[model samples]
Target: MKKYSLFQFCLGFILILGCVTWGTAFQNREAFRIGEITVSPGEMKSGYLDVPEKGGIGSRIPFTVINGAKQGKTLALVAGIHAFEYPPILSLYKIKKMIDPAELSGTLILVHIANLHAFQKRIIYYNPYDWKNLNRVFPGDPEGSISERIAHVLKKEVIERSDYLIDLHCGDGNEALIPYLYWMVTGNEKLDQTTKKMALAFGIKHIIIDKSRTKDLSQSKYLGNTSVLLSTPAITTESGYLGRTDQKAVLRNVKGIMNVMKLFQMIEGNPQFTEEPVWIDHYEVVRSDHDGLFFPLTEMGYYAAKGEKIGYVTDYFGEVVQEFYAPFSGMILYIVNTPPANKGEPVYEIGRVKEK
Candidate 1:
């Protein structure tokens, strides 16, 4: 009776092992295909997503894809939407090199530079050819401006292909900002919750839950919001400032991305979340009324009361042309660090913190 029981136990163990092996093989057979490249499991591939120009010449958006040995979720890490946002771009470069396909469970798509035109020309927010901000245009028109065409390609190619996305950013050349994240709270309850979890997992000290409902599609064309509308959970992050590439800021972004990877089970280990992140429900952008030199009275991350002086616009003679005041009590999300300012340009972004 004892010999018979041992034989049965061995037979059961072999069957379980065979099932596990077959499952893994099935997952490996499911390849990640994009732009004429198909990456099988445990493989890493790098290429560019081509964007054609007016003269038939074209530019390419550099990308790297890592298909993990085990099947799980695909996470897309994108940066350099604005040319001057160096930290996030640098982090993506480092991350692509560090991640091993054998260790990852799913796939990671890394776009090192989204706006190659702006990046190469050292332009700030807008693309040089179209003079339009890439971030503001999404699901773009094929026959539109160069910027719009790039946006359309990204939406159809990169964004649509991913299960989740992390759009990384830093302050433009003329701005200083505190590190924070913007998580869109769409009407989709499940997606909103998942995005919130991803935001918290990013390990940022401040989080802004954007709950704005816009009738115009242009108003909601931001990359993060557009991704959410497409049924993908996404989050946008801000870290470095003044167009400077600080290693500390770059490392922070790298670590935060790794944490998100863990949260999605693409990698192992638990995410280290902030003990309590300051949550804000809404934010307002303070724009200058006159073209002049901007003199900020307050710093980034400083809390201000309603009607408090946040900054001022001065003429060439140093005379105050316009005094900017906070419209509501809130924390300073970002501020203009560049001395020069233009009419209708943003001076500061203030967020109303939610009370516990």
Candidate 2:
């Protein structure tokens, strides 16, 4: 009897080991098909560098790309493109880990930190010799400044290599955003429609038209014919000014990314979050007319009526210098708390969306 019992125990153990091995194989199969590997920093691909070498102030750029191709759509997610936006980077990191290679149907490419130099110093705005803002430099030149060179490589490697791009960002050093997405206006109806659909796929509550400038170099405005063919549907999102490793913000971003993956059918699971997104066709920049202490009466993400007193600009003596009001009834998407605002500096963004 004892011998028989021992024989049965050994057989059971063997079966369990076989099952575990098969499960591991299944999980890793997608990574194999998609090619899971690191494209070392400073590695040259085609004509652009994968990432820079790490050096004090100017070191190697560490960026990881995880490709999960299950024979579906390709989506590219980028974080830390701006050094100071920590929440988005953490969000992308968590999402990368959460993505199961076995369940994914399409390819997912993740670029952790696009701007490694500024990221090292935790600086929001990159200060290159000839330029101050890396975000403004689109389709950068290979022979330009340090920031431009990095941007140039990104345009070729990640931007041109995927079917869709989700550039994650956060509020600048001075302001906090109400988790929103900025869609570039290409003046093409088809493109605009495609962009809107993609934004909805992310399950974000608000969508804003980034018309603050004439063009955006990162996605559309800078893409030439060659870049255009490589470019896919893209959306730039601001995850508020939450610090890096902020669990709340990270979870929110992960949820948004998962929704998009589900929409693309990259994952077998159903989407866990949904929202009726508010699409703003236009936004007005309410700038400060005089430098003083600005006290905000209303909050970000709140609905404000036209001519409503959103806040007050005051002098050092605590006397009200000027009261800032909305020009039209819209939602307060973002606002600043820093005092002593110079004249013509943007104070708030009022958004007006088409009523559903």
Report how far residue 42 has shifted in candidate 2, in Å.
23
For model 1, the stretches where C-alpha displacement exceeds 4 angstroms are 1-20, 23-28, 55-57, 213-219
Clashing pairs in 2: 52-60, 52-61, 53-59, 53-60, 54-59, 54-60, 55-59, 55-60
Cα lDDT of model 2 by residue, 188-213, tens digit: 67766666666777667788765454
- Per-residue alpha-carbon lDDT of candidate 1 for residues 1-50, written as tens digits (9 for 90 to 100): 34568888999999999999988786555789888788888899999888
| Stretches > 4 Å off in candidate 2 | 1-60, 128-131, 185-190, 209-231, 242-245, 270-275, 288-294, 312-323, 340-345
lDDT of each: 0.88, 0.66
Query: Whose TM-score is greatest here?
Result: 1
The residue pairs that clash in candidate 1, if any, are none
